[model samples]
Target: MGDYEIALGASTFIKQAIDLRPDVGIVCGSGLGDIVDLVEDKQVLKYTDIPGFPVCTVSGHGGCFVFGRMGGKNVCVMKGRFHPYEGYSYREVARPIRVMKLLGVKTLIVTNVAGGVDLSFKIGDIMIIEDHVDFASMVGRNPLMGPNDERFGIRFPSMTGAYDKELRAVAHQCADEMGLGDVVRDGVYFYLAGPVYETPATSRILRGLGCGTVSMSTTAEVITARHLGLRVLGLSLVVDLAPVGQADDAVGPTHEEVLSVANSRSLVVAKLIEAVLRRITV
Candidate 1:
């Protein structure tokens, strides 16, 4: 079966189980899955239960979909998001986004925990993704690389505005209002294909490339969301500092450390998301 068929089948199965049509879709990454707890009157469906769905193998992901209301709008929250590092193709990693599009999601909010590649960044800071350096896509691993599915989108979709401008403006305003103006920043997200963290040398290279935040996920999903014409808003939390020029034996990031930071600061991210959702026209 093709990707479009798989997405359609999943959406069909989900629609049969829930009467609500989502206006917004949220893909929670890594330890950020707790954001779904904000969903009111939620109906959850495990990935294992959904047809053509890929299960999450990572530790931080919840592996379920939560459908409910938030900010006075019906929404679908992906409690777990797939990654290329998990042995999935770029297309498979982004399939849920297509499913969300089929389920009537007009807007997509994606969040991930990333290492801070820029020297100015500190752990626990939130970076509003103004743009991204899709390293994987640059080498031809884009989610839209396969045969065209015109039913879902144009054969040649433009990505200049992949991150919605209006949504980002509102996110900034919301952060300021929440007294987090100093904590929140806007920068470029560098998408690396990784199950392993970057080495000190690679981190230096990323810094040279002007990457503000770096991670393994988000780009493929954002590309898919943009292809399907969904307005996208990306939020990245800096959980660890990239080891730029540190000594070879210097301590580096661990999955456990990333989870620890993500778990601790997730509420702040949740609050910012709630504020953004409430304030946006949606």
Candidate 2:
């Protein structure tokens, strides 16, 4: 089936569960599922139940979508998200974003747990994504690499300032209000095709390339969101620091460890999101 048709099918299925049209959408990352607890009057729908949505396979990843409210604003939260490392293509990973757009979502607030690539970052720090280097897509593995779907977007959607600057500023202002200024930082993030953690040398290389954080997801969905005319903002929780300068004996990150750290900071992530939602205009 065509991608547009697939996204329309999923959006139709979600509409069956709740009529609350969300202006803002959130894709919860890793063990950040606990943030769903902050959503009020939520209607939970499993990914499998949706006609074309991809089910998450990784452990600690929830396989559902939630329609709820925070700051009295309608919001749709994907309690979990698909990833390439889980055997899905980039298209599958980006489908939920398309579906959310079709469902009337105009803004996207994406969150994920990433390994710190920039030594300046500390574990539990939340990095605001000012830019991204889609290493996988840069090699032409992009999800948007296909026949043009004028219904979704033009064949060439400019990637300049793909992440909304105004929304990002609002995010930092919220963090400052919450006394998290020191813990919240801004930087460029890079994507890698991974189930494997980055090697210490790789971390150093990525840092040299100007990446503050690294992950296996987010960039694909952000591309899709921006292509569809949705304003986007990304937040990454640093679960662990990459061994950029540590000795050979230093430990590295693992999926289990990332999820554990995500659990410990779910509330902090949710508070920031809620604050952004409350202040975002249109």
Candidate 3:
């Protein structure tokens, strides 16, 4: 729940976001910031300019906010995401969602660059997150740890439909229509605390748990968005093919590789999102 301070802080982004009257909010993770550039008539605001917004301190993240029209609907975009590995509290990591809610955002589109733990996944692939294992929430570091805020959501909300089926359908339809189906996947995302890439053993453990993709940021934001009653749509760009079982089974991932993959594939990723948004009624 947003207390006075949190809610007040939201006012800053809200003041600017209101004019746009955004119904959709997009949080771009890692190499996905390019979507902000594709936004029509976009207005860019640096994270430093937004009061109470956490800064993104990683490579490949743009650390700003972009507002614009997409598919005839006003949208707000977080050009970069916050991470606990960057020393941000869970609440801080989720603040952007609260601000979006205050601004009347109804649907959240979250994108991340993930390592593919599922053996069948490959680099440059896009995985639509059908479900997730939120380590942060399981370990009690959830952004919603404090007292519940009814204004944001109920104390115990059902996640059965947290990620809207219609939105997922829209994404699938978009991918098929664009001939991007070959690179698209649907699976579960796993969240872990990471400044370092996971070890092969860890990858095996996650794979055994049925994780298709692994990310450090999106789940917290997803939980926040759901808590605020926003419909969620998550996608992970498979930048690295993780070593799931073998000892050093896969090639070690470098930030450079992740960046290159994301940079090169962003055009397609952007297209998928754009096409989906053009069809999303909410």
Candidate 4:
């Protein structure tokens, strides 16, 4: 079956079950699945239960979809997301996003736990994605690399300002109101294909490239969302620090550390998201 048909199948099942047209879509990152708990009148569907969906194997990811209302807006939340490092192709990694588009999501809010490349970043800091460097896409591993499906989008979708400026402004305002102005900032997110954490040398290269944060996910999904004409807002929780200093013996980041930090700060991230959602105009 075609990509559109596959996405349609999943979205159709969701629609029939929830019977609600969501205006917003949310993808919760690692250790951040609790964000879905903020949703009211929730109806959940497991990934395994949804046809044409790839189940997430990561520990922190909940592997389900929660449909409900948040910030006075109807929304669909993905408790977990797929990744290329998980042995899924880019197309499969992007399926859930296309499903979001089919479900009538006009705006998408994506969140991820990332290693902070910028020295100024603290473990619990929130980085609003101003831009991104998709290393995977640059190397021909993009979600939209295959045959163009006109039904989903044009052959060439402009990614200029893919992270919506208006939505970002709303996020900043919400942050300020929550007194999180100091820790909340915007920066470039560098996307790398990773099942393994970065090496000291890799971290140095990312720093030289002007990346503020680095992670394995988000970019591909954002690309697919943009292709489907969805406005996007990306948030990165700095769960671990990238390797710094010239010392070769300096320890790098680890998954356990990332999850530990994410777990501690998940509530703050959830609150900020809720604030942003409340002010969003559909």
Badly placed stretches (over 4 Å) of model 4 are: none
TM-score of each candidate? 0.98, 0.97, 0.94, 0.98
Q: Predictions ranked by lDDT, top down?
A: 4, 1, 2, 3
lDDT of each: 0.90, 0.89, 0.84, 0.91
Query: What TM-score would you give candidate 2 relative to the actual structure?
Result: 0.97
lDDT of 1: 0.90
lDDT of 4: 0.91
Q: Would you list the clashing residue pairs of candidate 1?
A: none
Q: For candidate 2, lDDT tens digit of each residue in 191-218?
A: 8788888888888889889999998889
- What TM-score would you give candidate 4 relative to the actual structure? 0.98
Model 4 lDDT-worst window of ten: 245-254
Positional deviation of residue 95's Cα in model 4 after best superposition, in angstroms: 0.3
User: Which residue pairs in candidate 3 have backbone atoms (N, alpha carbon, C) closer than 3 angstroms, thus clashing?
Assistant: none
Model 2 weakest 10-residue run by lDDT:
244-253
Q: Which candidate is the best by lDDT?
A: 4
lDDT of 3 by residue, 103-138 (tens): 778999999998999999988889999999987688
Query: Candidate 4, residues 113-197: lDDT per residue as tens digits?
Result: 9999998999899999989998678888999997999999999998899999999999999999999999998999999799888
lDDT of candidate 2 at residue 139, scale 0 to 100 = 83
lDDT of 3 at 126: 94
